[model samples]
Target: MGVICYTSGTTGAKPKGAMGSQKYLVVAGEIWCAVDNWSPEDDYLSYLSPAWATEWVLGLSSGLRSGTTLCFPEKPETVQSDIREIGPKVVFYSARMWESLNSTIHAKIADTLAPFRLMFNSSLKIGYRVIDARFQKKPVPLSWRALYKLADRLVFRYVRDRIGLSNIKWAYTAGASISPDILRFFHAIGVNLKQIYGLTEALMNAVHRDGDIKPESCGVALPGNEFRISENGELLVKPPACFSGYYKDPEATKKQFDKDGWIKTGDAAHITPDNHLVVLGRMKELIDLGDGNKFSPEFIETRLRFSPYIKDVMTFGEAVRPFVCAIVVIDYENVGKWAEDNRLNYTTFADLSQKPEVSKLILKEVERINSVLPDWSKIRRYVLMHKEFDPDEAELTRTRKLRRAFMVKKYKDLIDGIYSDAGEVMVEAAVTYRDGRKGVFKTAIKIRDVGGA
Candidate 1:
């Protein structure tokens, strides 16, 4: 019997899980075996939630069937220590994880490294490698490439060493779209990262090849990949090594499977001039900005999240407004580093975000992004969330998706406070303290002036 895992359904949408038979595992095993060129001596780790379909296959079965020693972190905060201890030959993470790591790295250091290869992506973007070092900003007078090689060796090598990514041969990323800055940083450094597109249903459909890695496209359909575009621009796929069907939800299975046996992926895609596939946005999540202009939340979110301080973001516009608005979450550790680097004093995340200087920084960033976007698609107004998104809080699913519907309903007062004229907005929030006591705080959030992007 095949196991099935659904899309978390956090977007107020229906949940549909991928179903596959024993053959799903069988073919996935074959693809996994050859893709990374795994060996009996490899060590791999599973840091993703077991409930996610990608983890169920790649993080679970791929490691077991291939003889890679699979390890899990004892605690979430200990992921770095675990990676250093295990020194996995292969690594995989979601776009969020990559974003978090990249944010942490960039906020702290912008250096270059020696030519040791480290793969660095989930699935959202790909074809990057981080070397064991980082380079400093210096004007290379001549063929300074030689000097950069020296600086990478002497200075940047410590970066990968600190993160225990010295020996990583391959890294994979997926789930959501990765920020362009984050994607460029890794490849520019020397990590062998590349894009791979797959769903729980089709499993692994498109993969970047050794020579055909394109930064903008997901890559060509794999060796046995078959695909077509529907009249509405949806991508329909069939792959030999992909998962076949849902385990038991025959209704979902029937809904996803076409009469011709192609798996109907609700995501839209287009074949580029170079033959690579560029995924647009989900068919379901399209937002109309009330001006007959459509905005892809994923697209807008990707741009907003390009700000290193933004760790998580969700925008709402749909049928309500002429422009988009957003809920922003800051990555505390990184923002904390920013605070320290600039000697900006703040007691907590709320304190830091509410500071006029910090608020201006975010405003400047938002405006920078909005300037290029059409007015209807731009994020006109935003609210900095005082409370961080956490899985235990139910604001996020186990896979770390923003439960937009849940959050919109649960934090209705907070969301409403953004549009209110009170410059300072207040809401009562219940949270579990570190001491395990439950308490409620009437938190106050200060709205930031939205600038052009």
Candidate 2:
């Protein structure tokens, strides 16, 4: 019997189902097993939602092909300890989850005592140099390599165990672009973090191999997959494992393919000389200012999200506006820790975000990001959002991608204040609980200027 799978519906639109034949599933499973070098003795974790194609294929179908043992956590909260216990041979996580774990680790590390903190930072520095050399395809210097070995024994090994990545022979992150900093950090700590580029329709297109890892690119295309860039810079793929079509949606199915048989991926990308694919955000999401300058909000957001305190960011710019602005969602746990250490009392996310000290802390992060960006692309102003964007409220997709247009419409008033001369603005917003109850939240959201810009 043929199988049907519904996408996560992360395109700020309605969900659609794709149909796949049994033959296709078998071929895909075999291909995945071969590419990852999966063996019968391998242990795998099934943690992500099975409704997601990546999880279903890799955790179920692929495991079936290799006769691998699979484990599932008791609950989502127990996943970390469960992972430590099982020590899976192969692991996959979406970029968001990896970033969240990165933030949590750094937040906790910052709380450590002086001697321990010094040792951790010093070891990481040595590890970075070794990994950097390896990424450049150059030999690691004898001294640094020796130092790294000692550091690994003393620091990185423990760090990896704590993070439940000590035994991960192959660690893959996909679904969305990951911060390069996060990838580098994992690599520095001796984790073989790799990026995968693929879609629900195509299953997988590329993955970073062991020796040829590139943190910036999503790695080279998989075997039996031909990828090319369109005239408008959209990534197109022809993978053997591609779905037949969108189930009961002919128009949508037809729109996915170009004049030729290649599937239009709707993502903008460029291939490096080494054949690694560097995805440059979605084509339709590019922002252009009136001054003949254009930038990818996703690019900027990725960099801003590297900050330990920034849980989420939604950047905005238009042909009419002179510069860009952002709505930032602070990492509650990390920021709350800061508040506690400073003896700042706060009852809620809304209250913490409105505090002048909190605004100042976020401004410093914005300035750090601004220092590396072009003048036109720098965020001149920003407001810490009172609440995190929720999928239930239609502010984000189920996969946690920002619905830019929807968010713009929902927070038009706040965007206006960002461009206005006002230093702060009071606003009332309605929040929806998971139970479907609604309540009004009112707060004076401060708009902070970056570097007097």
Candidate 3:
């Protein structure tokens, strides 16, 4: 019998049961063990949901094959503390989890004593300089190397210990595309964070190998896996541990594979000259502008999320539209600290998010991201969402991927206001409380146009 793992349904489509045989699962685990150099000596934290295929292949199956020690937190809320207590050697986190951790670290640093903050910032600057030199294949000066070691001992090590990642040996991030800036930040702090590219149907396909890491790419294909791009730009892969088909959905399963039997990954991707895989976004999720310009919303959104003040972003444009617009969700903790530091008082999330200072803060972040984007893909206008995108609200999937279609329909008024000359729009939103009670509230959300646009 095959094991069934349901898809996360990030596109707001019905979840499909992806079935993989026992042999396939074992082979997948063995492949990961070989690539990751897993051994009985390693300690792993089991935090990812078992319902996800990644957990099955990376945690349970691989742990069984490698005889690695597995640790679990007492509760979801205690994961950070538990990680510190256990000090696992191997760690895997989703993109959102990594981003949140980065935000938390920055917020904590901002609140620290000035002397310590200055030391930390100076240390990070040196680290970034070394990392930049290494990425560019330039030799680092001996003096810089000496300074980096001193900084690591004085600052980076402490930061790592506080975040419960001081002992981490193999840090992997997946589930969604992460900001390259975040990856670079971790590496600057002496963490060997690598990106993985895979899907439920294939278990695991590509992963960064030691010493060949690239923040912008998801590394080369794993051993016994092959990747190719189709005529329409969809990524096609043939992995050794491929799932059989979707359970009880033969028609849908049939569409997943091409006539030649390679699985159609439904993602737009390309291989670099050096064999690095760069996943752009979902094939259907690309935004086409009126002037025939096309860009991936994810491409822009992931970069924008690198800002500590922004939590979530959804970029919108279509063939009928001349320019792009966005809906931004601010990081309440970081932004709140910034507010208090500036002597701005706020009561609720809505009140804080709609503040004039907060709008300007987010606008600056948007412009920073726009600086790197193509002219046609630059965000012309944006609004700070009164509330965060909650998974309970179906704005995001369980894995934290945006449900774009659902969001577009749900926030039609906000999008309309963004496209128009409206200075602000009034929104009445329904929310689900922790006690399972439903409630509604109204707020006036302000929209801002980019200065250069």
Candidate 4:
């Protein structure tokens, strides 16, 4: 029997169901089995919900087609422990989960004893160089290779085992773009981490091939998939596993394809000289600053979120403003630990954020990020939010994507303050809590100028 899978509803629109034919599922599975080098002997971890297209293709279809044994975690909370025990050969975790794992690993490393910490830090440096060389397809020097092997055995081997990735020969991150730092760290530690780019509409698009991986590009297109850049810079995909028309929505489906029958991906991307796909960002999400400087806020936001102290970010300055600024949400656990380590007393997230020390810490991070960004795209100033953006309040979508229009409308005053000469702004925000309780969150948010371009 056929099955129906609904969209994640992260586009701030009604979820549309896509019907999958049994034949189509088998074909999709066969494609993944071939591309990923899956075999009957391979053990696959079934984690992501089958509602997601990636899981449907990679976990369900491929598992069936390849005759691979599939294992499921006992419960949602026990996935990590179960992974450690099973040590599956293949994994397809979401980008967000990879970032969380990276953060957790770093936090654990930071808390280690001094001698072990020294070994871990040194081994990581050696490992990064080795991984970078391998990714570039350059031969590792004999001396460095020998040292890397030692580092891998002493530190990285244990780290990978602890993260339940020691046996992962084909680990993948998809669903959304991930930070390169996370990808690099995993590869450095010998996890063979790679990225796959696809959409719910296009089942399997592109993935990094072994020995040809790049942190910047999402690797070459699959054998049956073709990608072309449209005149307006949107990525167009033609794949064998294309979805049927949106359920009961022929008009929407008609608009999603061109006269030539290629599916419009709505993502801006460029193909590298090596035939790798380098996705920019959503074409509709580009911020055009009247004078011709246009950039994607997601690019800067992703880089900013690489910091452990920062949790969520929403950047502003499109048509109305000349420069960029951001609203930041701090990571409560990490920042709270920082506060406690420094003997700074803070009862709440709001109080901790307002502390001069905390502001300075975030300012340093912003400045560090600015050092590598182009002048027009750099965040000139930013305000730390006392409370995180909530999906219940429509600030973020169910999948944690920012609803730009909603954010612009809801935080107009805060946006105004960022452009103004105000050092700080008092905002009384009406928040909708998770329990459906409404309350006013009044806090004076500091707007620190990051001086240099």
Candidate 5:
């Protein structure tokens, strides 16, 4: 069967479902099982966006080939408790999703359950070490790693027991880059979370392996897949599992493949001396400053997001532009901690974000990161969000990828406010919670002047 299915385009505009052949689907499953080294005893959690191809094959076909029980939670809220209930041998977690999981579990039951053998996440924000640093430290009296395992045994093991993953042997983060904090935390807690590199078009480009986990590298290319770095630092592939062609869309299909059957990926990636792949960002997302300095918006955002106060960001500039600017959302939990510890008084997220003292604090953090970046890559101006983005509202996809077009439209007024001469701008918005409840709220957007990078 051949039918056109849309792609989940995260850049430029809404995704257009492209046509794909059933052979493409069937072959993907065949390639992944062999390359991922799927075993009969392996079990998995299908939590990724199935609308996407690679995840769809891995969740359905590969799971079947591996002869593992596939588990799906009844509801989003049931995910954590269900994982403990099912204890699937492997997992696929997104960076933001895992961060939310880390936030909820840490805020609620971190010390209780923190250990499992074969846990894998698909999206990683930073490394696991970065995650552990976010919380208060507890003194332990065992193998440093074992103690974290015990925390999981105490708290997360019930989750494993409940989910039937009491014996997770390996874990992986696919699709997108995950935060360093989440990666480090899971590994610190006993999940052997590693990075896997590939895209929907080309299924198993590389497996990064169990013992070969690197800090940010996406691992090396798999055996039959051809990989190379272009002069512009882009990644080009010729995988055996690569698609025959985009179904029926010869124009789009021709745009991707080159002579001799090479598929040119639009993503920017580089190889470490060790030959591991370190993904830079989407080819289209690079911010080229007028001064001729180019930087990845994602890289900048990842570093900025590490700050407890900054939650969301959109950095834009062209090579010929004078400066860079962004719209940022505040991270309330860490920011609130800063306020309480310092005895700063604030009644709400809005108040804390707008406070001059808070702005100064964030400014210093921004500057600290900017100092490490090239001059053109620095953030020049920014505005703070009164609240976090909600997924159910469609600002973020089910897997938590920012719908840039959706966000740009939704926050058009606040974004414009960043450029206004007025010292502060107030915006009226419709907000929703995870529970699907909705409400209208008005909040002032605070703009801060950031010195150049």
Candidate 6:
């Protein structure tokens, strides 16, 4: 075997190492290059961990095969600056990273001078119209097209340059589910961001092609990969170069594939008549409200994350609870900036998170998401978390995918309070500092109801 890449463990289970032969890595790389249209002239940023299967396929194998120049950042903190300096043509980021970039852009615009901000917002409206028309396969109005061109010159161009995306030719986001709205936002701003879907066990399977982009789908299956939706709605794939098996784990390996040798993706999905692949959340992760209502938490969480104020969110609904509730993590930097601008004082993350004003701010965002959801699946109540989900704390994977089951166990009290009649819950959390010192603290976290629910 050429490599043994471990799954990200976002499903709240122990990660298994998927062994890949040299031919497997090579074929995966070749497929990626061909689908993304990589060439010798392209430049790529190498920021993802080497241990990741994606890095092996894109940075190592593909770089060698396509002869693309791979540039490494000086350090993790310097990635943005390095991108600004090097301006690589290709970049790949996880969903969280993409959301962070979107948040940063909006936060900066929020702080801009009133007149410039107004102009930018107006231009963006026109841009959105153009993007919508294009996605619907309708002709864009000439006036709207002209206005979009003007916007690109006056607003979008500057935004792209500031974010070091001016030279980005092919930007891809994966590793977790992302909001289609986020994809539309980027397209509206002239960034060619697309979603690609694959897994460690099954390499590259589907991607958005240049002229055939679908914000709501992961585009079509790659040239050498085939997809089939099983009887129970699980996405099954037969990739050109599937992973050999789980390292030293025969039982797990056997369970990964069906009798026909098709890899069971464990994700619910559908293939559209036009051959596009729309992946739902993990089958096991779907929330069942027991009253014949079921939904994907990721669908709601991704939309809520679009708000600059919300950094991360987890939605919960169970057989015992007919309505959905949520745990939200605020974007500390953005919220802190808002607090300062409004002359609101805060001492710590917990203090800032629990503030009445902050709760109102988050409530607006929650209501925005709830507006688009069904009555049965709407988030009726939510609590702003005291701190961000930490990978070191085992609440999130290194790739920033939530360990849902782990989080449920860890925050059992806070979740119970959301379903209960209580207005607040006392939360005692353990803290681990950078220097390895550990401590514990307690605080009262307020739960707010949405639309009197």
* CA lDDT of each prediction against the hidden true structure: 0.68, 0.85, 0.90, 0.83, 0.66, 0.90
Higher-ranked by TM-score: 1 or 2: 2
Q: Model 3 Cα displacement at 45 (Å)?
A: 0.9
Winner by TM-score: 3
lDDT of 4: 0.83
Q: Residue by residue across 1-453, what tens digits does model 2's lDDT show? A: 356777765656787887777765777787777678888888887888877778767888888998988889899788889999988878888888888888988898889898988999999999899999999899987999899999999988988888777777878888889988889988999888899888878888898888898888999988888999999899999988778888889999999899998998889999998899999998888888989998889988887888889999999899999999999999988999999999999877788888889988888888888888888889988999888888889887766888887888889988999999998888886665546777897778888888755
Q: State the weakest 10-residue window (summed lDDT) of model 4.
A: 429-438
Per-residue CA lDDT of model 5 for 1-453, tens digit only, reads 443445556663555555556665666667666656777777788876677665666777778767877888878887777777777777876566555555544433322334322232211222243334422243333454454454565545554454345677767776667656556666654566677777666665776665566656777776677788777877899876555556556677787776766777788988778778888988877766656578888777766665545666667655544677777776677667667768899866666777778888888868877888777677888777777677778777655567766776787666666656767788775665546777778877777888555
- Give the TM-score of each candidate: 0.83, 0.95, 0.97, 0.94, 0.77, 0.96
Model 1 segments more than 4 A misplaced: 13-17, 33-35, 60-77, 110-148, 241-244, 340-345, 412-424, 430-439
**Candidate 5 versus the native: TM-score?**
0.77
Indicate the worst ten consecutive residues by lDDT in candidate 3. 429-438
For 1-453, candidate 3 gives per-residue lDDT tens digits of: 458899988888988999989987898888898888888999988898889888888888998999988888899899889999998889889999899888989999999999999999999999999987876668999999999999999999999999888888999989899999999999899888999999999989999988788889899998899999999999999998788889999999999999999999889999999999999999989877868789899999998988889899999999977899999999988998999999998867788889998999888898898889888989999899988998998999998899999999999988988888889999986655446777789889998889896
Task: Give the candidates in order of TM-score, highest first.
Answer: 3, 6, 2, 4, 1, 5
CA lDDT, candidate 4, residue 285: 79
Model 6 quality (TM-score): 0.96
Please tell me which model should have the higher TM-score, number 2 or number 6. 6
Quickly count the clashes in candidate 6.
Answer: 0
RMSD of 6: 2.1
**Model 2: pairs clashing at backbone N, Cα or C within 3 Å:** none
lDDT-better candidate, 3 vs 5 = 3
Global Cα lDDT for candidate 2: 0.85
Provide the lDDT at 193 for model 2: 86
